[model samples]
Target: MACRSCRRQLALLMRQTTTATEFQNVAILRQFVATRPPRLDQRRNFGSTPRQLGVRDIIAQVFKNSAEPYRVVQATEHIYKACAREASYTISAKDRTAGTIPKTAEGEDLGEGTTMWHNEFKLPPTFSTWSQVTMLHMYLIFARLRDLDREVARSWQRQLIDHYFFDAEEKMDLVHGISSRGLRHRYLKDLFIQWRGIIAAYDEGVVKGDSVLASAVWRNVYKARDDVDVRALAAIVSWMRLCLKMLDQIPDESLYFQTESVFKWPAKNEFMLVDKPVRELEDALQPTVTSAPAKAPVKVAAKATA
Candidate 1:
């Protein structure tokens, strides 16, 4: 009987010890959980959540926000077309025949007199001259876009070049009377090669500074003529740098939509040339901001020497 009683006591003691041990283990686990640092919820949620919108995203959002892919493409095409038209307009001959020509004190035909181009740059009114000027403006925009997302830049550059060639082909048909598609295509192919060469040359010039840039302008745009005016070369180089700086200041969002107005050329006065050397043009192209000097604090007089 005593042996059986002792056996029961031993079994009861063992059960109690097991229960206590289990309770202590659970307590320890709870403490460990409570003291543990919070899990990185942000990291945990990263894969599930969408990324913040970037410039490219904002551009893509245009398509989504419109909900029509065709409309988005049409709008983009129209925008680029308008930009190309504006660029071409810079060199388009003004309708000098629209109004009566102004007479000087001497009854000379003012229209027959030397014009700005004749008086200053002496650039002839030729298709090549107009095309060069147009390309200059286009190149400025291209330079500004170099830092954009690769795909975005590629899309814009392709569209812009398309608009340019379209205009060029149309002009060839209408103005030059090259109605043969084969001939126009050949001309355009040549111009595309020229365009690529100009980009490479101009990029090199920009890296090397104003003198190198002027040399490129003379070579490509002026046809490397020995008689090319140094002053005109300097002026064009100055204008390019100025336009690039202006475009750089504009935000990417603004550029995506309002490109035509944003990329407009500066006023004639803004490009006025001084008699300084070409090196000075670099300084002229840089952005300059002048601020008013801080006012000195006013001194207060003591109470009438009281």
Candidate 2:
């Protein structure tokens, strides 16, 4: 919201200082979300290691490269579509997350797509839920896009996020029935702010540890619910680690050629990402106090005080 045009477009900035901050008090987390993450956090990338670029990544800049601007647009569109679908695909009928979708008849395994998110994790299938899920998927891709050269990566990032806004605004009009463009813009601006928080929180988690990442997922997707299952959060962190590992193996040119086909999620009953480790290291998930045994004063009380 620095410039009027930026406010209108809901354009996200890497750094921002709100006009409201000048007058009203703002929380420190809000300011943290607006700025870049610390350099140490960038260096501490753990589960999501930076990919080593191949010839394709390096040669993407050549004039002879086949990925023209138009093709990149198409690729980004596919990515956006895939992510939007995946966001809602796992919502089991039992949770009533889908507004118009019919309920399951006994044991049908199909609704839209298959996963254990809604039923097992107890998340709703509402628009807010869908957007939060979509943001996670978007982050997976964003992490990968950062591996390419700077200008090219920035272009792709902008295109991918612009596609998200287009889809999100359409949903506000069609699904939620918000007719006012101005109102939708306001909502989108709020969503952009949330997206900033996601980038910061998730990045810090990847560099730090699963516990940290779990907290990020909890606060963002779970709405900081008191009753959220710890296992569910661990599963999600494991899933993201798996996604980044797989994404790291692909060449950068693959995303430019076709993004949707490259991005993959676990199908129904196929989650093998080892969330058990999170449980085994239970101490990591919560704080513990250790009581130290007292040593007798000074010389082990060998010589009693007079």
lDDT per residue (tens digit) for residues 177-244 in model 1:
46799999998999889888889989999999999999998887677888986777777687678777
Give the number of the best model, judged by lDDT: 2
Position 3, candidate 1: lDDT: 66
| Leading candidate by TM-score | 2
**lDDT of each candidate versus the true structure:** 0.61, 0.68
Weakest lDDT window of 10 consecutive positions for candidate 2: 14-23
Taking all chains together, each candidate's TM-score versus the true structure is: 0.56, 0.60
